[model samples]
Target: MGSGSFSSVLKKPETTSFIILVLVMVGFTLANDRFLSPLNISNLLAFMPELGIIALGMTLLLTAGEFDLSVGAVFALTPVSTLLMVQNGGLSLELALVIAFAATFLVGALNGFLVTKVGISSFLVTLSMLLIVRGTTLVLTQGFPLNSWDGDNWLRTALAGSFYIGTVRIYASLIWFAALGLLALYVLNVAKVGNWITAIGSNRSAAVARGVPADKVKIWLFIATSMLAGLAGVISSLRIASASPVAGSQYELEVIAMVVVGGTALTGGRGTIIGTIIGVLMLRIIRNGIVLVGVPGLAFNIFVGVIILAMLVLHARFNKSSERK
Candidate 1:
């Protein structure tokens, strides 16, 4: 490749992450031939989209200098509420969906209001929201798993159904994830709103002074973040044909880790949808690989720590090089 081409490739934020993903895949495959087996690959793809959808929303929040810790709980809350309404309240599925998502939207709006209007820290506000939402879900469902779908519905199928191609499975959730990811990429890189978000994260007061509706944009992003989480939750419940009140209980931290490891700054002002995708895949692959290779699942986070550290170094080097040029 020409020097210019090489430089351009290196400058792309996801390059190192993609390289690491390939390395991890190869390493795991070498360790256990099953890593690349059709069963394992199908399983990985089936489960990945749940987290992938959440990570896309997180990328936007991080890029805008904000985050919603309540997403994990929202993931559970939305679907559980929808299913309950359908089963117990005798509501139509479509109406149940609208009501459930609207409730989730209200949660997001309240979170934004507390942070941006009430002068509370986003972290504390969202953390509190997490607990509140989780508690509400538990109380509503009495800690039981919601009933599964017995009849076929196009919406449910579109959200979570799967079909096999020979021995390989293709899931509708994966399709949803990819479609949303492409949309997110456009929003973050090609849209004017994206620039406004970046500006707010880079310097909030300055962005406000420059005529960006910083607070309003943040509120909308918060809503978007929660809606994405809810969608993921709904998809997840449909995939298993049941919604657990405790589903996605730990997803908040995992999504944050994926975003950070994918090259998004924890403190915000920068992020990449493609990098988040790589991060999500890398983490899931490592998690799957560990279990297959006889490593205890408890040690999974150890690998995550090491990978995060390595990514930090890699990103720093690339950034330094870019600055020099």
Candidate 2:
């Protein structure tokens, strides 16, 4: 490929994402006049931290050429674990949070182990994990929401509650999301581990030959993804002041979609935290716009499906053009 072709291939992802973002914003704004308002933007920002956190991990995982279908279950299970610890075990909120995060990390480690050591596809392993974790949540909750935790105030105030800046109320998770985004950007763009991650995602065998410790990288990605999911779950529970078994149902799809739509290649080796952030914002805004326009919630899924398909088609076209050159 000539220099022009090489540069075009490199620029395609960013260009496509930018186009999609503009279209989403314009379409939604046209659908609902309030979609571009500060309040609606703020609400969309609130939606971002949870999915954004997960997508950060998911982006890493995807860049490493793996998927974690179990994230939704882990997300749901984290809050369940915290609630169980606080309600029946009488554990302090801090302790419960620690235990919950530890459990998620373990789940992630197991996922990495199964995929790398046992040679199982991440899809199968994480799907099985999804069922297992969801079942465990059901068993623990006995199919009921646990509203009995007594330490809601501290937990709520620390992570989920709104922080006021003059007349504006910002969700605390937003700060966490921004911090995580910057951290992820630094890791993926500047850190040694980030280079290893991208190398492994690009070619596992090549990365291994270069002493990248591919398995360890995969394992760490799994742990990171799960830990973020766990944190999101806990913060979400604190925000709501209760834990429900179904609290994060289908979250994996949403997070994965956000990452993929943001220009992360499922086949691996190319993605950006910034692009994923924009993708999350686009999805959240669309969802919020749907409600504002009186569209049924069910229709939001259709919209997401359409967006994902469009992104995939664009990705494929970009690759084909590059290959042709």
Candidate 3:
């Protein structure tokens, strides 16, 4: 039993993700000597946080057997709304941010209400929301980029600027990514809500019968997911000094792919934020590596698609084998 338990632990998704990450790192390093250079590393880390932040939220939602396809829409919408408030509405930047977030929270609440109270399927509801939010963003921005951000603003610097650590530069977004990732890790592994999430995913009816407020818990998760996406959007817009109406287009697919690649079950009931981090890193490195090796940017998606398919197949097989044992 002791050996069996050890083996089971070793077979976990986090372990697999870690091993894959290491292997990919080694492969990339061998392919390009510049892969480990300080500039490349810094850039890679910098690029990860936006998607990483969104992926963290997706991890929680998926673990609870819920989906939020509208995250990308929320992401695009938040920055657009913030910029509009600042540029057209003549509001203070900070106040604009506050209002943007409040709006996103309402959007999340609507998603939660429709799914939890109205009995709409999360997938369908969020999909419709994705279209609605994206459409609103396009109509508001008139399909143009909003470039009214002040780079000198303290808030902008704190949210998207770079800091130096000796000779290496680190992005503030990366700091946010690490801080949020650790916080998510703690919440998913140590908090009582984590148990509730898993219970609801595993057996919603059973969990409800056991006195868990399944609807409330799920609604809260939906809200948290949208808020995270909103924050990511703001950070991204600030980083670029612009908010494009088309920003975060197809991000829903990418975020879901990241969560699924991290070994979170598509049907939910099992996941780890730490594993998702590994998954994020692995995919990011692969994408970066492909570009470094002279692959066309358009081909990047093809590789990502192939990798996700392979991982899913392997993950399913592993589960089947474990069950047989």
lDDT of 2 by residue, 1-325 (tens): 6998878756667568777788878877888888767677677766679889999999999999999999888888998998798788988878887888888989999999999999999999999999999999999999899975556466577689886665456899999999999999999989999998899999899999988899989998999999999899887777777889987889999898888878888888986888798778767866777788787877877876787788878877887777743
Q: What C-alpha lDDT does candidate 1 achieve relative to the native structure? A: 0.90
Model 3 deviation from the true structure expressed as Cα RMSD, one decimal place: 1.6
Backbone clash total for model 2 is: 0
Off by over 4 Å in 2: 1-10, 148-155, 296-298, 323-325
Per-residue lDDT of model 1, residues 92-177, tens digit only = 88899999999999999999889889989889999999999999999999998877766568888778888998899999999899
In angstroms, the error of model 2 at 199 is 1.2
Return whichever of 1 and 2 wins on TM-score: 1
* CA lDDT scores, all candidates in order: 0.90, 0.85, 0.88
After TM-score superposition, what is the CA distance of residue 5 in candidate 2 from its true location, in Å?
12
Runs in model 1 with CA error above 4 Å? 320-325
lDDT tens digits, residues 1-325, model 3? 9999899887887777787779888988898999998889888888799999999989988988998999999999999999999989998889999999999998899998999999999999999999999999999998888865774678888889898886568889998999999998888889898888988987899999999999999999899999999999999999888898888988888888888888888798988898788888888888888888777888878987887888888778777877753
Q: Candidates' TM-scores? A: 0.95, 0.92, 0.96
RMSD of 1: 1.9
In Å, residue 180's CA in model 1 sits off its true spot by: 0.3
> Considering every candidate listed, which one attains the maximal TM-score?
3
TM-score of 2: 0.92
